[model samples]
Target: MAVSCVRADPRLVEFNDIKIGHVYKKTVTLFQFTAASPAMVVVPGLLIPEKQEEVRDCLLIHVEDTETIKIPLLEFPKVCSLLVDSVLDFGCIAANNQVISKHHPITNKGTAPGAFQVQYSRDPLVTVSPCVESLQLAPPSG
Candidate 1:
């Protein structure tokens, strides 16, 4: 029985600045040449975690009656960038027992999603809307 295997195309795949709640995809191709009546090839899949971290690994492809082939994979750490206004001015207000509101915007400028919270404030009168411990912001689209 004679059998041969070819290396995967694009031998290495790199994912850079991947963000949580976002999906990235890659494809690899493998070729085989054999004279045997029946041949089998196995390709493995990868599963990445949701947390932000760096990953370096490889995929193993098994070919019957042949040596295993290796394809390298690299994943960079997640990054989140945000931009906020320097100052927010509420202006002057009388003590007439009236409610006042102001709008503040936060923008995400990085490739990954980000979470933020208003942890501290000196004045008791100051408050933020949607007062949740964690607020999620999606990355900007290109």
Candidate 2:
């Protein structure tokens, strides 16, 4: 989604140069996640579980080439836990998705730039949305 800097919070920054709509000269894909499919792919070995969920049903954009690809994430609830378990418990399985988690600097432990440690903060951003704090979706285990 093309976002602008006009968002009330500066921390949630946006690109000023890019416009807020599909920018395709000839073959621009206006993907609408109007429906969910059962045969979606999960990428845990490639990325974090939480990160994988964010890209579900989201459209991807190649800034330079304008080559867009629709990323359809795991739709099944069972698949969600399994994919999440792989990443959160073991590792991630990224394929071609360009987005990533945070970037860990050279001094940090992770080998890659996006495998940074989770930084927590009690700042106003956390309080931006109420449901963000209230809803906790965890499966109960025996």
Which candidate wins on lDDT?
1
Error of 1 at 106 (Å): 23
Each prediction's whole-model lDDT (CA): 0.68, 0.27
Residues 1-142 of candidate 2: C-alpha lDDT, one tens digit per residue: 5421111111111211222232312122232332432232322212223321223343243322544444332221111111112232214636374534432222322211222223446654322212222222233446
* TM-score, every prediction: 0.44, 0.16
lDDT per residue (tens digit) for residues 18-102 in model 1? 6665767776776655554333334444445587888898877775545787888888875667677888777887757777788
- Name the best candidate (by TM-score): 1
- Report how far off residue 114 is in candidate 2 (Å): 38
Off by over 4 Å in 1: 1-3, 33-48, 79-142
Give each prediction's root-mean-square deviation over alpha carbons.
8.5, 24.0
